[model samples]
Target: MTDTPDTLLDGTHTVLTPEYVEFRFTLAGIYSRFLAWLLDTLIVMVGTGAILSGLSMAMMVFPGFASALGFVIYFLVDWGYGIALETAWSGRTVGKRVMGLRVIQRSGVRIGFYHAALRNLARPVDRLPFLYLVGGVAALLSGSYQRLGDMLAGTIVVRERRLKAPSAIGAAAGEGLLADPLFVSRVKRLSAEARELVLSAALRREELRMEARLRLFSALGTKLQELLAMEKPAHLSDEKWTLLVAAALIPAPGARTSTGARAVA
Candidate 1:
């Protein structure tokens, strides 16, 4: 998947997958990225300090060992913080969450540990010559606002869209069905992981081979039907049925959690 240069003027990065499933993202601006970085740095420092403070008594016993242990603690906190959180939280660190930002692969999917590590490992180079100057120049030149780390990692920081109700889910009348309080209530009870699966499958259905797609959706539709104790309409395909569930699970505005970026995670 790659972005077309024609769509860059508005700062939108569109990925057209091999099977033509498309995704769009608004690239994070430098100011917002910087702020996110600042917040994350402070948090890292605080966390590192707290851990070190607990070892104060150990330091008195062995000054040399304490210095070495301090370095290790700093290293783990500095490196492990982003890697662990990004992998677990679907590309969001605490600072990124506060700033409404997320890191995603160029393929428009949630970042894995490899992606997180690459980006975090490159941060030193991005900070080269002081204060993220290298990274800033790279972002300015890249047009999509990607830093050196992002370029190396094949990932981009993006502004998350506000959660909104789906009007339709693949020709199923989601809006109309959502009007039924019982239907909405049942769907709202779907676990976050299940809802994420439903949406991710719907969004990427075009990318799967036909047999795989059919089998996958059929199983999901059957399981979901059983769980929700609801019957699919006689005419709706399994894929369409799954899409309907996906649409129903999207949270309205002001909701705390999200269905994720194109149901990424």
Candidate 2:
């Protein structure tokens, strides 16, 4: 099923999911990214400082003219440190980690060294025309918070929020529904195209026509209940099936009230 951000419920503040590409960076996300960046930067700075100090001391032991090498050593150290840190850790430098943000691929995947290098290398261009205007405009326009460098390199900067329990349940429940022995066997026996159609229908419920929706839901509900009765997973809670279905739809992290409203994280 090809899910899109438009399918998400309006005013529904759910946990971020792989299917939901539109990440809204909240206050907490900003703070977290900042924190992560700070931590990383401090580590890099200390390491660089120590290495440069040692190099300077070694250079002092050479002839007087050797002092001219200090500039070259300084430039090399700075360039190496910046590139290594940015590439190794994605777009996050020390500052970005402190802000709770990490650079990733647009598909919510980890970025590799090449993508990181491309974005970091373009940082100067992104800063042109005052106030990172180019980068800001790119981020605002992109589906994810991808700037010009990110677009060129196929990467994005996203807040690193922890997945909530409900989010996990949402992703797993789709598989759980088809896990029944009879259902599994039947699905497995179908042609690949038929199997895809059935699975797509189940996952992307909104795509079905209204009549189809009713028929599919009723039949699937009955079949699922019967299957559950045969060999229920011991760890499955006794919560109402309807509630679980609702929770699956409106997934939010952390515990909620009896009314199913989310509390503060």
Identify the leading candidate in terms of lDDT: 1
lDDT of each: 0.76, 0.49
Task: For residues 1-265, write the lDDT of model 1, one tens digit per residue.
Answer: 3443523542777776443444467787788888888999999989989998998998888988987898788868978999999989888999998988899987777788999999988887998899999999999999678898899999988877553334446356433666778877898888755775677677666656777677788888898899789987788778777877776665555668944434422
TM-score of each: 0.66, 0.42
lDDT at residue 164 of model 2 (Cα atoms): 31
Q: 60 in model 1: Cα distance from truth in Å?
A: 3.2
**Once superposed on the true structure, which residue ranges of model 1 sit more than 4 Å away at CA?**
1-10, 19-21, 62-72, 167-234, 237-242, 247-265
Model 2: per-residue lDDT, tens digit, 82-182?
56766776455666656645665554445667876777677668767965678767765655545688788876555444433344336555656444566
Model 2: runs farther than 4 Å from truth? Answer: 1-43, 61-94, 127-145, 167-265
